[model samples]
Target: MKRKLLFGERMLLGDGTEPFNAVIPFRLHGIFKEEEIRYALGRLQEKHPWLKALIQYDEQHIPWFQVPEATVSIPIRLVNRENEDDWQEESKQEWHSTFDYQTKPLIRFVWIKGEVVSDMLFVFHHCLCDGGSAMALLYEFLKVLDNPNAEIGLENPILGIEDVVPAHILQSGKKQFKAKTIGRLAALAIKCIPVGRKVIDRQTDYLIHWKFDKKTSEQLISYCKSRGITVNTFLGATVLEAFRKVRGAAAFNKVSCPVDIRRFAPQIKDDHIFAFGLMIVMSLNQKLNFMDNLRLMQTEVERKTAKLNPYITMMVMESAHDALKNFTRLLKRGKSSNDCMFSNLGRIQIPDQYRTFSLETVFSPSVIGPLGNTTTMVTSTFRGQMDFSFMGSEGYLPQAEALAIRDEIIGRIRQQLDYKTAS
Candidate 1:
């Protein structure tokens, strides 16, 4: 079976040139056989049909997910475990490597083999899945790897716009007319607006990862709870403050946070391999204090989230398909107004102990898109420790500044927690 790509998916596919990939890297403790890992992936492929499908373009130049009769397995690349930082280096390389979507599966695995401890990187074309979907896949992979008899179960995914939006809505003449009118106006505006002609070279992309111990992580959670806010809201405020401190007050205070559409779209299960992104931009109020700024940001988050109509957004984007190239051009123009993209996956729910192997740590998933600004910070917690992976290119943000920003974010969070405790 085959289905046409959604507008979001097509944007991720780009012009089939640069690699737009998402990677989830984690460390495992115990002896794991290569054959067992391979077998686990095979089982996963059987459960998730998209893992075996390839992207094929039709004559109209639109992409489609085509499942072939022959079974296809996700390719795994094994590398000798050198040191703790090997995954980071490999992740940087993966960012530049383009996928041959027609020949191979959109997803691939890289195993850094070690005797006692090993690190594995699950890389996927951003068009195939989001971080949430990737995490679900990771959970199943570990489950089957520990016990080959384990049942991961199959997922019934909503394949197209027809599934997401009701037939009545799509077929409504009034709705269609409004959607087309808005789409054409937006497309015209996009064409009329002049963007930068020069492209900023993204040189030397780097990844910085660090984790806070159980004590600090717990304190952070307590602090957020006491403040009547979430960890995501607090982190958003902290990220904005860090940029202001490092990049000057004149720097943009905006941070784009991707909201998991599964919360709103029940048809898209957690196990479904889908790439549609729903995002809300949060900006700090420079006039207010840190705590005040955080509260305001949280309020805005609540309001924006409550008002987010996924169906309408999906419909509008699909209608604006003709203007996708202009949207891509705007992104590639290297004139982003946002400071960075901050994604907090919250506490990872995957089990730590398997019958055969134990999950030592789950590093935050990192992804760098070909879009101009590559400054992104991804956070997740596993086994009571909060882990972070900060990825950026020197062209967008200098390496030294990126390190300073990372330190500032951590320090700011700790400062808030410590101050609250002292009071």
Candidate 2:
């Protein structure tokens, strides 16, 4: 089974040299046998064809996911867990490790072995899946790991662009003309745009993680609800404020948020391995108070999200394949304008208890690639606690500064909650 790579997937695949990886780490508290893990992985591969497929390039250098006659099992690397923080170190290591897409599957599993507790890491190339798909896979993995006979449903994978966009839209000559015209114009703009001759030196990348206890998490959620703003918008405002406070004049005052394409396109299921995403850029009003700014930001987020046309965006992108080199060059050389990309996976609904092992907790996933700015903040709530993973490079944001920003975020959240309580 095989399918041509989508435009976004091709861009992420890059020369297959740099690693664009995402890591999902969770702690399981119980004894787990290697065979059981392998069994679960095998079931997953059988369910999702992409998990067993490798990448191959045609004469035109276009990439396609090709499945061999004998599918290879997903590789598992077991490491003895030396300390509680070992997963963080391993996650950083995985960020730089490139997948040999030509010979191996784009996904791998890392088992941090322990006496009775194990931290399992699911590391996959970003091109293979998004956070939504990862969560679905994780949910299924836990189910099958508990019971090898668990009947987790198989995925009806998206084959190509036609599967995502409606047939009517694709067949329309007027829309095709618009897509081609816009794509060409955008490609021309990219070529004409002037960028720095030298790319920003993202010296050393690092991940900073922290958690808010249940009480604080609930209070923040209540605060946002009372103010008629989403937790995402509230956190987005908080992070932007933290950057502005920490970096002072250096802050860009803009935060980019990636919206899941599944929300716009119902044809893409939760379990499908796909990575196309729409983005919305947000900024706070300097003149307004924090609460007022959140309301404004929420309004902006909704407006921007509503206006997102994933179908047309995908069409325009697919039409501009010839200009991908120039677009990539601009991303590599362009001066940074955004503060950071902030993503909130919201609450993970997977149960903590299983028949064999009890899930201790889930860490907010982290991802990094050869892209221009390596600054990203991801938040997710599990078991009533909100977890955060803030990743950045030393060249873009020093470790000390990242720590300060983390502290600033926590402090701001506490302050807001306290004020709301007082009132």
Candidate 3:
């Protein structure tokens, strides 16, 4: 059970020493034993083969995911719970913690142990999976933690590019030619693009987390619904507007949003440990009113999403393997172009209660890589409340400025809801 890492995976792996980690933190409101957690993690690894796999490099230095002859236990770190906010600090610690990729699996569990309430954090190397995959694993973990004998089925792992791109698309000579041409052009552009000789400092990373109560969350959702715009687009507009107002002329007026690849490629299941994503860059029209601007942005989002071709995109990326390093350099040193990357996971579907422990809540996931810009906003609704995790570094965005942007977002949403109430 071994396969070479895909292009996107290699980019994220980044020499295998630097950490590109994602953390999913959730609270459980019942007593849980360490053995129970170990049992549950074992079951999770059984369901997803990649969860137990380790990275190995061949003579040529290309990395591959290989299941060891003997099964490896998923690493678990236990911490005494001091307060409710301990998980956030622990998450920051995990962000900078690099995985021993060659020897161990690219995932770990941190248990903030308490008598009645325990906070569990699942941290993963971004190269192994995306946020959607993490959420699916979280659902399964809770299910199995309650009942170790839970009959969760096994995963049929995606081995190579052939598994994702259909036979017809892979064999199409014309499409192949098109993809190769685009790949060459892109590589050329990256080579020509002027980037700084050194990477940005991005000093002292930080995370800001907050949640709206059920009533306020519902009202915000209702406002977006009444305006006939998606919560994602509305949020994107809100983020861009906030950055513009706070940064003034310093704002880039652009936001990059990651569209889940599973949405377009049926071959990639919700539980597949895959990390490839398609992104669309959006900005607001400065001249239009807020509602009108949201409508336009929504239209643009629809258009871009409709035009996305995962098959071709994957094919093109695969053809550009030789340019991976250069592409990575551009990402690390290129002048910042976007205000931030914003992602809305929408509503979480996992049940909040089990037979034993009642799930307290799920925090919006946070990710920070060594990439040039670390500013990002992630929002998700869990249990009738919308949660947000805003991450940034002092060098890329001052903590004070980030706080101002956060307030602006909350204020803008409230102002819109208030206007609706008055009308």
Q: What CA RMSD would you report for each candidate?
A: 1.3, 0.8, 0.7
Model 3 lDDT, residue 211, Cα: 96
Q: lDDT tens string, model 3, 1-423?
A: 999999999999999767899999999999988899999999989889899899999998888999998888999999999998999999999999999988889999999999999999999999999989999999999999988888879999999999999999999999999999999999999999999999989889999999999999999999888988999998899999999999999999999999999889999999898899999999999999888899999999999999999999999999999999999999999999999999999999999989999998999999999978999999999999999999999999999999999999999999988999999
Model 2 quality (TM-score): 0.99
- lDDT by residue (261-355, candidate 2, tens digit) is 99999999989989898999989899998878988898899999999998889999999999988888888789888989999999999999988
Best of the candidates, lDDT = 3
**If both were scored by lDDT, which would come out higher, candidate 1 or candidate 2?**
2
Taking all chains together, each candidate's TM-score versus the true structure is 0.97, 0.99, 0.99
Enumerate residue pairs that collide in model 3. Answer: none
Between candidates 1 and 3, the lDDT winner: 3
- Tell me the spans in candidate 1 whose CA falls farther than 4 Å from its real position: none
lDDT of 1 at 116: 90
